[model samples]
Target: MQLDDALHAAFRREATGLEGIDVAVYEKYDRDPCEPIIGLGPREAPIGFFGRDPGEQEVRWGEPFIGAGGQKVREGLYRAIHGAALPDFEASREVGRLAFWANTVPYKPLGNKAWPMAVKRRFQPLMAAVLVDHWQGRELITLGREAFLWFGINQSRETRQALDAFWKRDDRFETHHDTPLQLENGHAATFRLYPLPHPSPLNQTWYRRFPDLLAARLESLDAARRLG
Candidate 1:
């Protein structure tokens, strides 16, 4: 938990300067505003998910990806794996445990907006460390543009530009991109990033398609059998 300690300490130092976060909800939960609200699966999980941040439901539940938007993703996984719909929130969360789940900031920003890029940068190294040190899987399903492009945070200029270009392509979601990342501990690997739209009710255009898109992704990964 050294990385957690380090990240929490760093967050405490800079959280006062941060804006666009629901301080009241954190207060209500008696949760330290600086604590990262992450969702972690068992170390044996075969795949991981990268998201933007937590929401009100996440803060209330003391975990990420349990809100309405996350429930959609969870339901998709369960449906794809079990060939049936999720029966309840508990079952959805159960399916969530079959994979790794994390986010860029791991906190709830105000109005459910994405965390500021500056905050994401401050915690990027430790976040990367969490993924590298905990998860043995290199395949990640990144939800939305922010989650996918976050891989380029500390990468070279050319790499960042290329990732942006890839995001704009028509076949972006159907394609998988490899992003090379190195932890401070010298562990390096290329993580396979599969792009997908964020499954939020607020995202009207793509919200309806998220289930089908996610089902295809899970099928392509053979995730059901792997999890089984």
Candidate 2:
């Protein structure tokens, strides 16, 4: 089988095994739980955003990060560019110009709950292929603690501590960033992982702070690209 076909088959196998995702619920919403939301842009964009999973909006739209939180992200990008919202700003294949968007788990759960550990484990290999083998991304902005931890960042105590600090937003640990991530396929590469709090309104504190934080990250990425 071709690589894409193999990946799709893998996704279908895992989705069939997921106890958390209700097939009827997906049908009710007119979404296909087995369909992965890979970004619409070039696979090899230098910057990437990794979210936990696709939400209902994303599943319906066949895109990752298209709900309220995604709207904030798009706005943040425009803010980085024009310092204000564009009258007609919208995310599209063009957004890939700056970065590509993806998720740790490509499938949507029933009610936006975290995926079962079994599901995450089952799909890690495929997700690694999407990020490392297909996209070859350099800088990754992980949208939540889980998304940050998704990149095989838990081998040593020191690494776990760094992930914890990132989760807690410890200022003293701010200076230290990025991890030399090795995916399951043995694709070793350095990825700058900016762990940000999930931008959901449920996360009230970070919800307000997400815009500026995202803008800064985008600006830093732009600067780096220019320098390179």
Candidate 3:
């Protein structure tokens, strides 16, 4: 089967088994009038980006990151890879070519609210499947704290310690970017995680610096891809 079709079928099968308050919400927002926001890019892509969840724009467009924050990410990636600025709201085909993009929560929330633990737990396995099984991604660039924190919560105690050190701005993360983690599906893998502040305009503290950080990470990812 084609990769995208296979993934959709897998997601639908998983959806059938979900049960909870969020199930109703997931069903309501993930079908018919709304479309499930699946990840974009080739399965072989070495770099993947994770975001918290989709907004209305993403739900409507059937893409992961098309909102304002996404624009910043795409712009930065384009600058890093091609050394030029990308036009705002360029189509997904253009922006998504740089790397794979997914979200911690596949379904868009009603008001773009944070997904409850119930929702996160339910979809964690599927998220792992997409990133590890389907994409085989080696590096993950997480957009916000909540996105990467989920990994720490479900990972080993040793990994949790490393995450804490990274949180405290330890230099160890810089020297050894890769960390071993166990996905919700019991898949063991080593991933280089580039945790960055959200590119939302509301996050004024890192708003200006986000582009530089993203560009640097993209360059690093490019180097790694070449080496591999």
RMSD of each: 2.1, 3.4, 4.1
Winning model by lDDT:
1
State how far residue 91 of model 2 sits from its true place (Å). Answer: 4.9
Candidate 3: tens digits of C-alpha lDDT, residues 8-109: 776666555444223444444464322347656766777778889887666556677777888888777666655666755664347576578888877666
Give one digit per residue, the lDDT tens place, for model 2 in 36-61: 76663556566678889877777666
Better of 1 and 3 by lDDT: 1
TM-score of 1: 0.91
TM-score to native of every candidate shown: 0.91, 0.83, 0.80
Which one is best on TM-score?
1
Across residues 19-106, which tens digit of lDDT does each residue of candidate 1 receive? 8678888888888777777777877687888999998888888778898988988888999889998999889878887888899987
- Residue-level error in angstroms, candidate 1, position 60: 0.6
Off by over 4 Å in 2: 1-3, 22-25, 88-98, 153-162, 165-169, 172-176, 223-228
lDDT of 3: 0.68
